[model samples]
Target: MDVKLPEGLEAFLAAAGWGDAVIEPLAGDASFRRYFRLRLGEQSAMLMDAPPPTEDPAPFLRAAKWLDANGLRAPRILAEDAPRGLVLLEDFGEVRVREYLDQWPADEAEVYRAAIDALVELRRLPPGPFLDYSLAEYQREAKLFVDWYCSARGLDVDAASYSAAWEEVLSPMLPRQRPGVVVLRDYHAENIMLLGSLGDQGLLDFQDALVGHPAYDLVSLLQDARRDVAPELEAQMLDYYLSKTGAGADFTADYARLGAQRNAKIVGIFVRLWKRDGKPRYLDYIPRVWALLERDLAHPALAPVARWFDANVPAGLREAGGGSWQP
Candidate 1:
């Protein structure tokens, strides 16, 4: 099998000292970036092919540095060719936690414990070099539910008021008054690489990290939209996080709000990926996400958003437009 190289990417790999390595292209996410696994003898590394105009490697570079400094296992930057949007990175290897779970079902609790521990460790770092996950940003993101998803479904309602409702509810919950910890926006099982039997995890797809509510990443982990985390485990993990962090009583409410917020954004993003970006596989995850969204809305803290749903969206439409519900 042959893999086409992005323009100038081959030259960069050579200059970066991997000219003779075997390059195996890996499946990329819903972005313009591409990754190649380069193996030469016992030495292995990953090469990023993030093209210009559509993508930038700087955020990933900055994030990698910050994560490594904070004792997380982000891939080390072995070499860089920023002008051509290529970076040689230390390969963290395969075996995503989600994949690992397929064979080791009993390790579920311990694996989530490690992930939650990573989040706790991350919260200790001082915020720097990241966008504040302010109310405006949250509103902008949540509005995606109205923009792409609603339009795709042809569901016409008050999108403006929808945003207002979000602002009214979230302004107090995730108030823009202060700074926050760095949030790896897509922290989930797929993005977490299970490095060893010792329960270490490697972070990936963190170029979109931002300063946001500490609960945001936690919800991203436990209430993953792409995969179903057992409700029992989810509850235990939440308790574990709260116990270790000693957060106030508002912690549960915060988790529910951000969970709803993130899932709604993902609903829109999945639709956009299909209708605009021509990727339809994400639609299969909608039912999973909708289930998570419904659970989040059930929280009393989300009554305002729930009322909006009850009034605007019918029960059947709540799960409408979703593909096959996978377990």
Candidate 2:
């Protein structure tokens, strides 16, 4: 029954004349950000409490402005308390693309197509000065698997070997990054809302946007760790996005390679969430990540990384996170 806000958040809302609004806590994602739905009669807005030192709201503010300017539905910013890391934002309603798909499974294609179109629109934005999501940076991410996951299992996988394998796998693909492609690092259903007149996607959690490979966001959608997008539909969506786009014909290989790298990093991240952050919810997603990793590794371009995993990672380790991952 304690609906009271914390860390001056209640005072912040009260100052905004929303002290009487009914605030309902919303389920948060894997990040440290917290959210609440503030309702004042029929009018409503979203409250983002990203208390700093642990979380920052500046990037969210910047990305939202740029995305909105570019015509993507990034939620209009209503108000902000920067020092406190609180912001009131335009609510994109309650229907997420994921929830919509659950309600009308028949509209799967239409829903996903809208999301793709939003991505196509966003791909045109001139990227900001965020950190480059470079191969070297990702190689460090892959080392998380060696540092935490392998260590947890009491295996001594050489970090140098792991980084070397990533290098071999990514060497052919790194320089191929599509210039100006502002990859919204997390573009999956959970963060995308189904809304607006064009029925297109509304984006969320893109404060970490970075300049990177074009296929990165697309792979994020199709190879979602949160939900299973049927393989056939995944292929269709991929084909749909590529048909009219100017990406090279061999972009499919690039997509698969990025997918492999992303998934590899995610598996390690999920493991770290368990071991370091003490958040075990992500542990359930590891098998799903492994399945995507398997699919990505299937690509000929991922041979070195695939071979590395096959040789260094034991069968028991592969099966540690229990879930059914099929081809």
Candidate 3:
């Protein structure tokens, strides 16, 4: 109710002939950024309020432009105040993949297939000048879990052992990987929108687009936050991706490694979200993520890391904040 607009934002809207518009705050995630839906006549727009010193709209704008140029479905930027970290964008509506999936469970396969298709198409585009979403970056992100969540649960993680095992499992994977065009780091159900019947879903929150493996986005999608996509479906989708990309026989091992790596990182991320960010709703999903990690670890290719987790990591760590693990 007390949504704060940037300085001179009202004036800017007034001069742009949108003075009569009504703005309402929209639910936001953990980021410092805030969003508002603006209604003008029958048309609507979305405004991003990213306060400066902590949030910047430049990277998002640049990534959006690059995606648009590369034939992706990112929102078109209508206006901006980069210095103030504010951006006005075309509204993509409220039909997230989560909502659509809930409404039409019978269409899960078709809808998820469409999402996979979009990911493949996005991966086909040439890489842009975003940022390196490298193994080091992933390692850094994964460590956040131990620092926050593990510590919160009163678990003392052997940092050296964990890092050594992680590197032992993931290091060899880097060279074997065929670099892809670009990966939308969080290309999941929540970030994708069912725009309409245009056969195109809206891509949102892709500011972290990076140059990475083609399998990365697929892992993010099937291994999502809101729901537990079945392992069978996950395998089928991985095979579908492999076939479409012509990735050859070597891809199977690499895909499994990537899946394990992604699941591990997400487990840590979900923990950090609950422990540090005070978003405990994510805690209930940790067990499912850990189960996915365990399944991925079953691949013979991940023996070293799997052994470390199974041996050193306490069972209490997995059941730290349990809700349901079978999903």
Candidate 4:
């Protein structure tokens, strides 16, 4: 069975002046979006198939323009047909930070430092036009654990208490995010492209960008789901970021708090991907995320949420497949 190209994809590519290009299917992420690598002689571009109503390319377009205008290394958009959900984009060749580091483990410090530097640079810019990562949004995301994880594991826990715990833990930290920065919600190694040397990073998968606490993206980078960042490296990167930004003492606590929140969201998301979307491979990352979440929960800032977890989610069930359900 061959993978079918989206309707009108060929015409869209031809209209973008790459009519004779060779198209090759590219690996897609967790979203409904599909990608193709197009080559015509010396010219190459990425074709994004973000068909609606399950997918939309408008947000990607908006973030790409904003990032490029602000001196960030987002891919350049060559052409777009928003309603049809097709776009031609600059091909930022295949060297991703994760794969690169896997091959050259010796350069971890240099590469990670560059990633932190990119975050610092992003912090200096005015946030792009986007919705805030509001308290309601925070609570909504946090509840995914209870919504999907608990239900899947057959646990009849106190849902209201879980919500209350998150409220107690997160409310105080909300004010610290006043006039937040543009947080690329998925700023991890996989989405990062090694443009040239150690420090040159090309960004991707930023359609979910939001105006949120700066620490959020830092957590996303340091506490990645798919990759295991060393504890020492995570510490060095955190300190490096703080030294560069001059963030106050409270920043560490904020980082821990956000890490717990983000990790919890990811656990639920992975479960949802398995149970709802039929993508069970995401289950493999659960143990890693659980470890990160537990570490984050250790901070005093997360005591309330930590207590809730202690009482609700059993230690055995925290692993891949909720200690029962299998792919």
How would you encode candidate 2's per-residue C-alpha lDDT over 3-24 as one tens digit per residue?
4465887788888888899989
By lDDT, highest first, what's the ranking? 4, 1, 2, 3
Best by TM-score, which number?
Answer: 4
- Kindly give the stretch of ten consecutive residues in candidate 3 with the minimal lDDT sum: 318-327
Alpha-carbon runs more than 4 Å astray in model 3? 176-178, 319-327
Q: Write the per-residue lDDT of candidate 4 for residues 1-327, one digit (tens) a residue.
A: 226888987788778788899888988788889999899998889989999999999999999999999999999999999999998999999999999999999999899888888899888987779999998999999889888888888899999998899899888888988788999999999999998888888999999899989999999999999999999999999999999999988899999999999998998999999999989999888888988998998999999998998898887776542464567
Off by over 4 Å in 1: 175-177, 319-327
Per-model TM-score, in order, reads: 0.95, 0.92, 0.92, 0.97
Please report the candidate that would top lDDT against the real structure.
4
lDDT of 3 at 173: 65
Model 4 misses residue 242 by how many Å? 0.4
Cα misplacement distance, residue 262 of candidate 3 (Å): 2.4
Candidate 3 Cα RMSD after full superposition onto the native fold (Å)? 2.8
lDDT score, candidate 1, position 68: 95
Could you give the C-alpha RMSD of every candidate to the true structure, in order shown?
A: 2.3, 3.0, 2.8, 1.4
Estimate every model's Cα lDDT from 0 to 1: 0.85, 0.81, 0.76, 0.90
Off by over 4 Å in 2: 1-4, 196-198, 319-327
- Which ranges in model 4 have alpha carbons more than 4 Å from their true place? 318-325
- Per-residue lDDT tens digits for candidate 1, residues 152-234, read 76778787778777876787766532567889989999999987763778999999999888999999999997778989999
Instruction: Give one digit per residue, the lDDT tens place, for model 3 in 152-271.
Output: 556666777777777777777676444556778788888998888425788988887788777778878987756879878887888788777787676677667777777777777776
* CA shift of 198, model 2, Å: 7.8
